[model samples]
Target: MYGPIADTIRTQRLVLEPLEVHHAEEMAPVLDDPRLHRYIGGEPLTLDELRARYAHLAAGPAPFHQEYWLNWIVRRVRDGQAVGYVQATVTPAAPEFTVASASAGATVTPGPPRLVASVAWVIGMPYQGFGFATEAARALLDRLAAHGLRDVVATVHPDNRASATVASRIGLRPTGETRDGETVWRLPRRAAPT
Candidate 1:
């Protein structure tokens, strides 16, 4: 199982470390912001809810169902304070559960598992528009690419213009499809310059 990698990643302005239980205190307020949760699927979380969420997330399989759902905390390099969180996991093309029609019989489809890295970032309301999300995402993508992952993807709510822009800025182009009403963008693997 790919437990926490224990490696630290540093970018121009931020550092990414594996998420720890203590980060819940700092992250709770950021996640509690209603504006930030508008595009995210769930309602704003309370401090107690955030703690339980982390506990459950941390208790999941090390090498999660697909790959690892490695969650990391983003911190500013200048002051070393937690500002956000990011996570990555493999995509199972033929996920077990599928919707069935009321009249028609079920249909089965099989396909190879797609190795994808998905990311999410949140900077406290005060830090919005400061480029923290973009920087953190770029760093995470770079880290995954360095580990030989290909075809990274980011799914964002169509109305989330800021996140959509961040995906575009990071080189992930639209894939022309939506999952659970969320727009998806992909960045294909390309050899880095020699």
Candidate 2:
């Protein structure tokens, strides 16, 4: 399965610009607050560190791995200043998985070759409460859906109510699965249009 290529996505108030190394300098201050790391557990990166990291990410996924590392800087369309970022780590899914439906006593089988996306979002402390994260994430999911990548997932620290809210806003529900102490949330794919 072919994975997504980095591309720009636009919404009413924000632009999801494909991430480039040069964005590190601008993102440093936006991600500088230590409070932003309370749930994610990492100190803010310096400009140099961020630049190095961005360089690697900009290079795309490593060879031999059928994966995509798509990242974007969330910028206000009017002011054109980056305030946050959203990303999707996409991998080709197994042929099919059987899922048990609670309301129905039967097993359900998903379609084949569906791409699985593990998504994340981060907005600077000052940018919180502005709905930037929610908008960016919603746009990202729309883009993924357009690409025919339907299995969307996010891992959030159980205590991070803010992130949980964002996930819910983007149509994800808690899956009751825990990985690395984070709750797993998933969004079911929409039905195809006739």
Candidate 3:
């Protein structure tokens, strides 16, 4: 839904490679630990399941929604191994409420869809505490901004403190909203400094 699909994002210590079905084979093992699914739920996906899932994502988002499902496999630069992933679900934001409700002193209502992106990140258990997730996520957010996205959001389970921290580090603030049992974090776009 943006330009030529999601491009590969590079960071100081890692690379966010555009996700492909073949990457699933390597990613399966990186994501194999059961603990990695503690908050996301479900056991680790088998190679086949991951491949199928990647295939669907690689095909792009559904036409009806006009959403862009962007995904990437995070690989460590030193070892060149897949260790995690970062993704963004990009869609137009509601255009009706152009101003903040607080500023208007009245509740704002939805209008035509305008551009927003929802992002998520996950790193293999062993990769935790190394800032790989943060680096990859920061790079992903940069890419989204380059595509002219002004609103970005992330949903994290309340119990998933690690993810919440990562979200905060990337400038998302808790909106005190929950969806399907996950806290919603939002980063309103800021004007670039001159």
Candidate 4:
């Protein structure tokens, strides 16, 4: 149960708040946009589906899977309405390596578990092209860094230029490798020399 503290982050034009069960109503339509899902693995979400998604993410834990996802809702600061969602999680390095090896039909090697940060984000279609994604992402990254997290990573579809740009804008450099057919980008904890 690595739940994050419920906090509000203010960006230039947006306010990101910890995503709660009550946000599903405002999130449903945003999640339903097909354009947003173009490069994402899952299908567009309906209201019911979004509700289920929130419920699943908010649930404490289950047998096979540990609930480590921290979700947030992005809203227009002026209007105070939901526009999208952002999420991050810490994945244990050993398990990730094991899963990668198993998926590639290779033998798994025993190794000490390392924690890596992972993140994902989406904004409503109407809000796209306005830098909302970058704002939210930078805010999230700052929060994570404040908590002493290093090695933040993001996976973007090869053709998703928008997301790739967002990653670049937030200082994540390409890892020169693709996993599950998605390009990987990483940001280490050390700040670039000012």
Could you tell me the TM-score of candidate 2?
0.87
| Model 3 C-alpha lDDT versus the unseen true structure | 0.87
lDDT of 1 by residue, 4-90 (tens): 343677888889887766778988876777787788867777788788878877675554355566678888899987888877765
Q: Kindly list the per-residue Cα lDDT of model 2 for residues 1-194, writing each as its tens digit.
A: 23344678899999998999999989999999999999989899989999999999989777988988899999999999899999999988888777877875878787666679999999999989989999999999899878777789999999999999999999999997999999999996677689
Q: Model 4: runs farther than 4 Å from truth?
A: 1-6, 63-67, 95-114, 189-194
Q: Worst lDDT window (10 residues) for model 3? A: 95-104
Sort the predicted structures by TM-score, highest score first: 2, 3, 4, 1
| Candidate of highest lDDT | 2
Candidate 2: residue 167 lDDT (0-100) = 97
- Please list the C-alpha lDDT of all candidates, in the order they appear: 0.76, 0.90, 0.87, 0.80
Report the CA-based lDDT of candidate 1 relative to the real structure.
Answer: 0.76
- In model 1, which runs have C-alpha deviations exceeding 4 angstroms? 1-6, 62-64, 92-114, 189-194
Clashes of each: 0, 0, 3, 0
Clashes of 2: 0
User: Model 4 Cα displacement at 91 (Å)?
Assistant: 2.2
Write the residue-wise lDDT of candidate 4 on 94-166 in tens digits.
5433433555587866555556779988988888898899999999888877775666899999999999999
Pairs of residues clashing in candidate 1 = none
TM-score of 4: 0.81
